[model samples]
Target chain A: MRSVALQKGLAIAVPALVFGFLVAAQWATLAAPGSRDVGIRYIDPLTASLGRLQDEQTSLKAQLADVRAKLDQLQRAGAAQNGTVRDLSAQLDDLKRRAGLTDASGEGVVVTLDATRAAADLTQDRLPCFAPDLTDIVNAAWRGGARAVAIDGERIVASSSVYCVGGTIVVNGSIVSAPFTVTAVGPTSSILAVVDDPSQLSDLKRRRDQQVVDLRIASVPAVTLPAYGGPVVVRSATPQ
Target chain B: MRSRVGGAAVAAVALLLGVLVVSQFRSRDVYSRSLEQETPESLTTLIADLNDRNRQLREEIFDLQLRVDRAQSQVSGGQGTLEESQRQLEQLEVFSAQSRVTGPGISIRVDGPFDDHALSDLVNELRNAGAEAIAVNDARVGPRSWFAAGANGDLVVDGTGVRGPWTVRSIGASDVLYVAMTRTGGIVGQFQLIYQRTRFTVTRENALDLPPLAAQ
Candidate 1:
């Protein structure tokens, strides 16, 4: 009877211990770096919350536009002094000078850059929503001193991402389909220098000449930039 | 005899517990090891290094994909395609977008002696007032970021902690955002109405990048 009891204890304890060990190992694996269940894997914020947000933005913009239009009409009727926000030329010029672009207008050239690769493989870099090539020209243009700059029609702002999603330039809040024209209000000379710098290895052009995504520049004194509307989204450093 | 055995077993259990406790104190576990990685620069450098390496790997993948079309591309033939690709990719990576426009807007640096809660409240007010992107030092304040006061009195908006003179850049009608932030029933005024005193540096710039609303 004692032997039988001892044998039963051994069988139960041994299997229980083994099962416990396996469970622990599985937990550890799941919690490991680059883990399957780590929850660190990214989810697209756009599709996740964007649809709802866009609807909200649309309504807000419509209301704001309505209010502004009414106010403008009222002012035109001489109800009060002009309350329109003045153009940001001085600020634009300063930022332009800092960015190395000069302003232009009237039948100027528009340069476009597109990713040579397909979108399937294009993923977000450490800084989300930014592509390497896009950063280069924007920076070069800024360093080249671009005046008023726009990606598509959305005015390129501080922290604006020149990113690729499946092969399109996702600038501002809109999809800027390829031939990403970065229109800058600046001197054509500086814009050309940026696209054709010998020291920068004339990199933008290599892409341009290869007909991969490259820079094209033209000078115009009257290139009109559409006004930016909607809620302003501010981004800062990533949360630790 | 039973009592004697029981006492001995208890003594053994206690001794084992003591040994485990001592071992635990001596062991360099996750928390202790992570201490080295806790430094600000370590994390930022780690992030930057990872970005560069990731970029390198990406360019390689792109090249490989292109090579798939041809029987033999330079990548496998010791063409050193990787290095050339990095050269092309490097110049563009450094100038991460900050402000790419010529504009007049506001630079409302909202950080002060308040705790993280207060700082978050202030920031949210600015956003609700139509403020654009806000960068606290290196950290970008998106929905993913959490604002908290660190062990050091610095108000960390994102992973990056900031203190006085914490610059908040917004590309909207600055005056409106400014008034709303400080207006009664607003964040700044609410805190002031409650605490009676709060100090911060708020300036308005005519131009600031309201980057596509942080991709919604």
Candidate 2:
């Protein structure tokens, strides 16, 4: 009787053990931090590299500032030494303004372009603004008699390049995400007229009407645009 | 017979515990590997270092190019080309935001609740209006400048947190920027139509001084 009972119990215990083990295993799998229960996803190496590059650019910018300060001091000292140097220094200042290297504040307008919350949540293609759209705005600003134009503080010069990559706009090698603010320093009336012109910034206006982009334009008493921070290397160009 | 039953129950419970432990260990190992590999703190520092290195390299390359041009101009015995090179160098210095600039412009103060998207749009509008230089709360805006919401939900520009009310200084015609900003059915107008609690104000300044991108 004892042997029969032991055998029956063992038979029950074996399946019970396996069932319990299976349940436990499934629970364990679900509970892990990287499992379905956790929403955080892994970042790929390409993103990692982009992050690293941005960091490097910032530190280098600080160094560039230091070097520039020293150069300014030297230039000032040279200006003190001779009349010719002083005149040349003045000329240099004018050139700086033209080169998009000097930060200047003057009468202008600030236009803000942003994706509606809904649009931003959608696919990149559905987003209202792209790199070319900004380029068109810059052109319109120029037509409006803008002396200088900058996008999100990046001074746009003759050599400045604009492109879109992965839903971000890159201007002069800097990534500009929306809401994109385009500041143009020029004649207020002309800028306003241009901004109001149905033909001017028509693409943006169309997108706004289509509910793809949210755009804002305002005239302030004063505005300041930062100079370009990208390298200006003219390797092959010669004087005309 | 009772002992046999109790022993079986105990054996089953032990088996369950053992399986749980092994499964948990394996799952954790596998999922954790799939999770984000780097910590935020580490990524921040790494990015900063890399940006610095890249800037330095580009600067070095620029300096070398300038030297080559200078030498070539001298070898060619063209004083005009030399002058042209010198002029270009000076222009590059300013264009690169190496020099400080100041002038009459407009200041747009966005007292949040606002997002990075809003600020970007404002900047774009400013550029369209012909802003020469711009700064967001004193951090000079540049080609490398980027804005994003930080982990703490604050707007960060180029890795620096910008506190509100965010002041966007653009050197340009203050009146034009003001009108462009406050025009009816424009950005500010549209913003008011949606979120009524937020304040967007544009002030025209007679003189605004924007420092260089970096002084360090």
The C-alpha stretches of model 1 lying farther than 4 A from their native spots are A1-64, A72-109, A116-130, A165-168, A200-203, A207-215, A233-240, B1-216
Predicted candidate 2 versus true structure: per-residue lDDT over A1-240, tens digit per residue: 989767776677676667767776676545433233233233455456766676666666655655554455555555555455567777677666766667878889888776653343343222233676676676567657777899888788744655543345666656565667889987888878978899666767997887667777888778888766655543221222
Q: Which ten residues in a row have the lowest lDDT in candidate 2 chain B?
A: B28-37
Model 2 residue runs over 4 Å out of place are: A1-44, A121-129, B1-57, B60-216
Worst 10 residues of 2 chain A by lDDT: A120-129
Per-residue CA lDDT of model 2 for B33-129, tens digit only, reads 2113233343344444345447645775567456545544443442323343356454455444555667778888877677665566666666555
Model 1 docking tier (incorrect/acceptable/medium/high): incorrect
lDDT of 2 at A41: 35
